[model samples]
Target: MPRYDYRCRACGTNFEVSRPMSEASAPASCPDGHDDTVKLLSTVAVTGAARGGAPAPPPAGGGGCCGGGCCG
Candidate 1:
């Protein structure tokens, strides 16, 4: 199940609901039973490195303005 964030316009209350992706767009009621609720766009935070491996270094020799002294 995925969690979705919602806000109630009636009481200005924010809450979260867990449901299936199929019902992701379904209407949700607030804890105070407010029907005037809207689904909020939420940002997801990804943690940890993939496969327990460190991140790869940036590639070198890209002749950008910062690297090529064109901006200097």
Candidate 2:
């Protein structure tokens, strides 16, 4: 199951749901029973090891280390 983000057109509410790919395409109703919900395109962050078993480094400047650059 993939997690998807959705936005309610009627209420302008945003929510996340986990469902199958087939169900993802269909329109979903809001928890408030409004039939104006639309799925929003969202980006997911993924982190793991590489194919050669090497761990991936953290994102640049993510450590708050002077934007990943050493002091002059």
Candidate 3:
């Protein structure tokens, strides 16, 4: 449960909350009942896979730049 993005500086409300993580710095109230909220610093765009799958094979290079085989 981790989703927090609040911005309510008295009247500029913008909210999104999915609590947890120790309240994430507890203190959020902005449904037009401003509590002087400000905790909007969110940027999460994670998409991938990693779990003993296939991604660990690039460590012995010698051709300059990855295509390593002797530059021309």
Leading candidate by TM-score: 1
List where candidate 2 sits over 4 angstroms from the true fold: 51-53, 57-72
lDDT score, candidate 3, position 69: 70
Q: Point to the candidate with the largest lDDT.
A: 1
- In candidate 1, stretches whose alpha carbon ends up further than 4 angstroms from where it belongs are 53-72
The candidate 2 region of ten consecutive residues with least summed lDDT is 63-72
Give lDDT tens digits, candidate 2, residues 1-72. 898888899889888888898887877777788888888989888877887999876677654457656753
> TM-score, each model?
0.73, 0.62, 0.28
Better of 1 and 3 by TM-score: 1
Per-residue accuracy of model 3 over 1-72 as CA lDDT, tens digit each: 998999998788799889999989998898778788899889989755556776545557643565677564
- lDDT for every model? 0.88, 0.81, 0.81
- lDDT (Cα, tens digit) per residue for candidate 1, span 1-72: 899999999999999999999999999999999899999999999876657598644346555656655654
Scored by lDDT, model 3 comes in at 0.81
- Looking at model 3, residue 51 earns an lDDT score of 65
